[model samples]
Target: MYHYDNYDQTLVDERVAQFKGQTERFLAGELTEEQFRPLRLMNGLYIQRHAPMLRVAIPYGLLSSRQLRMLAQIARRYDQGYGHFTTRQNIQYNWPKLEEVPEILEQLATVEMHAIQTSGNCIRNTTSDHLAGVAQDELEDPRPYCEIIRQWSTLHPEFAFLPRKFKIAVSGAQKDRAATQVHDIGLQLVKGDDGETGFEVLVGGGLGRTPIIGVMIRPFLEKRHLLSYLEAILRVYNRYGRRDNKYKARIKILVKELGQDQFAERVEAEWAMIRDQLLLDQAEINRVQAFFQPHPYAELPAEDAILAAHKQCDAAFAAWFRHNSVAHKVPGYRVAFVSLKPLGIAPGDMTDRQMDAVADLAERYSFGEIRVTHTQNLVLADVRQSDLYELWQALTALDLATPNIGTASDIISCPGLDFCSLANATSIPIANGIQQIFDSLDYLYDLGDLRINISGCMNGCGHHTVGHIGILGVDKKGEEWYQITLGGSSANQASLGERLGPAIAKEDVIHAMEAIFQTYREQRLDDEAFLETVRRVGIEPFQERVYGDH
Candidate 1:
């Protein structure tokens, strides 16, 4: 994790103080709601359906155990006793008092954390692969680049107020776990033909009301010009992106209207003007890269005898190990996912106690660090294979050991009408209903690598556009209806899902989903994943099964 320098600390401290004053003024009637809207939003505070929700940025989804404990304390003392981990890999306090939000910001600053750029029409948090340095397939760790962007974008005067919120994601791994293709700016680290590292840049990809996979703006961007090129793109968007309509303001919309070639040409022209001025030297790249050097991993056997024995003895532990643990770059180590999608709880809601316990577990087992995934789970990225059993036990005690990492039960969902005022229907209940129906582990494993993402509305906060099976909530007259999409993915070959058919009534959503699953099971070839089957046969079969007799 990148620790803050004095400059970083000072900047955050000053911002906290400034926001404290702004919040006080709002409460004292010095600023009306209209006046305070942008200010509060800039600080990641939102007036939700029932109370004020404060989203705290977990930059690139990285957290130290100390920071995690502080977040637990904030959740315990300020809001309700839990916080919701979001698709952006941030945490949200849904019940925080408006008056105490400034205090929360102050507390977050003490741990090198802040809420700045987390909301409003500005460059949001720069996210990356949660398994960054530890992934076996990675060409290089992307976090250094992510951190560089974070520092550059944070309150940059030039981009302080864009037409709409801009999101950037970087993926250095062969697999695109960071969902880079669906971001405003997606940078995939690639080795150039000359054997030098560079980027494959994608632009105009986003999910909201209009979903589109990003077009490859640049097949290869030199490392030295990363910042300058990003600045150029932002400049182009800021100057030409729609300001008249919020819905049409995203960079994706601009790219769409102008066409990919024209958009790229505009960015290239802008880059030619400023690229030389912002060119990064090797030293600057090295300076940022120094923070992400490999962890001091011990030399251990490829297989843990005790762990193997424990797996043989405990069926539950074996299930968790099979599903929740991923291979690490180093031998004898694993990246363990702490599943937040239990049977009844909201998908990513972690109680304060669970947070504190996970912090403790991270300190004891994974070098005191935690990584939040875009799928709304936590990652202990350096757990030794020898210690897997004990860690699994501890996580089980905290109800965090759900053996359904990529299964249908491991749903990705947004805080829909239950919390978000922009939502038309409730997403949490739909997610819960799906989880309950797919409760059997054997059935889930049979379904194989199926993803179910839900969003209350078209804001696409749940990333429903990328799920293997996407459930979108809609308002029909006075009734709640759900729309389904199939074959959407944010992985290596990113693509937006296609709508299955007419919206099903909310009461029939579970049945429709069941039919979809059944269709997959019956239609799939040997060991083919749900996504593979969807692409092979198309959504017509599943759609017919779901809506055939309706």
Candidate 2:
């Protein structure tokens, strides 16, 4: 993790002080609601359906054990006893009082964390692969680049307020776990034909009211020009992106209105003007890269006999090992995913006690660091294979060891009508219902690699557009209805899901999903993944099963 220096600390301290004054003014009636909207938004405070929601940025999803403990303390003292981890790899406190938010910000500042750029029409959090440095097949660690972008975008005077909130994701791995294709700017680290590292830049990719996979704006962007090229893209969007309508203000919309070629041309022209001035020096690049160097790992064998024995002895342990643990770049280590989608709880909600315990676990087992994933899960990226059994037992006791990582039960969902004012229907309950339907571990394993993403509305906060099975909440004459989509993905083959059919009533959502699953089970070929089956046979078969007799 990149530690904050004097400059970083000073900037955050100043922002906290400024926001504290702004919040005090609002509470004292010196500032009206309309007047305080932008001020509060800039600080990552949102007036939700019930209370104020405070979104704290976990930059590139990295959190030290100390920072995690601070979050737990904030959850315990300020808001309710829990915080919701979001798709952006951030954390949200839903019940924080308006008057007490400044105190929360001040506390976060002490831990080198803040709520800046987590919301509003500005460059939001820059997210990356959860297993960045630890992934087995990565061209390079993307965190340094993500950190560079964060420093550049945070409160940049040129892009302080864009037409709409912008998101950026980077992936260095062969697998696109960061969902880079669906971001305003997606950077894929790749080796050029000349054997030099560069970025394959994609622009105008987003999921909201209108969902579109990004177009390749630059086939290969040299490492030196990364920031300058980004600046060029932002300049093009800021100058031409729509401001008359919020719904039409995303860079994706701009790219759609103007052809992809035209958009690329505009960015290129802008880049030609400023690329030389903004070129990155080698010293600066090395400074950022040094922070993310490989950890001091011990030389251990690839296989551990004790770990193998434990897996052979306990069925539950074996299940967890298979589902929750991923191969690490290091020989004797694994990246263990902490599943947040338990049976009854909201998908990403982690209690204060669990947070503290996880922090302790991270310190003891992995290095004293935890990672938040885009799938609303946590990652202990450097867990040794020899220590797997003890860690699994500890996580089990804390109710964090659910052996369903990519299964149907591991749902990705948003805080719908329950918390978000923009939501039309409740997403938490729908996610719960789906989890209940797929409660059987054996059934889940048999179903295989199914992603169920649920969003309350078209804002697509849940990333429903990219799920294998997407459930979208729709309002029908005050009655809650759910719409389903199939075959969407954000991986190497990124594509938006297609709508299944007419919306199903809330009561029948579970049944509708069951029908779709049954259809897959019956129609799929030998060991075919849900996504492959969907693409092979199309959604027509599943749609017919859901709406055939209706």
- Tell me the deviation in Å of residue 461 in model 1: 0.6
Clashes of 2: 0
What TM-score does prediction 2 earn? 0.99
- Measured against the true structure, the TM-scores of the candidates, in listed sequence, are 0.99, 0.99
For model 2, how does the per-residue alpha-carbon lDDT over 376-406 read when each residue is reduced to its tens digit?
9999999999999999999999999999999
Clashing pairs in 1: none
* Native-to-model Cα distance after best TM-score fit, residue 333 in candidate 1, in Å: 0.6
Cα-based RMSD of candidate 2: 0.7
RMSD in order of candidates: 0.8, 0.7
Q: Model 1 off-target regions past 4 Å?
A: none
Which regions in candidate 2 have their CA more than 4 angstroms from the true location? none
Show the colliding residue pairs in model 2: none
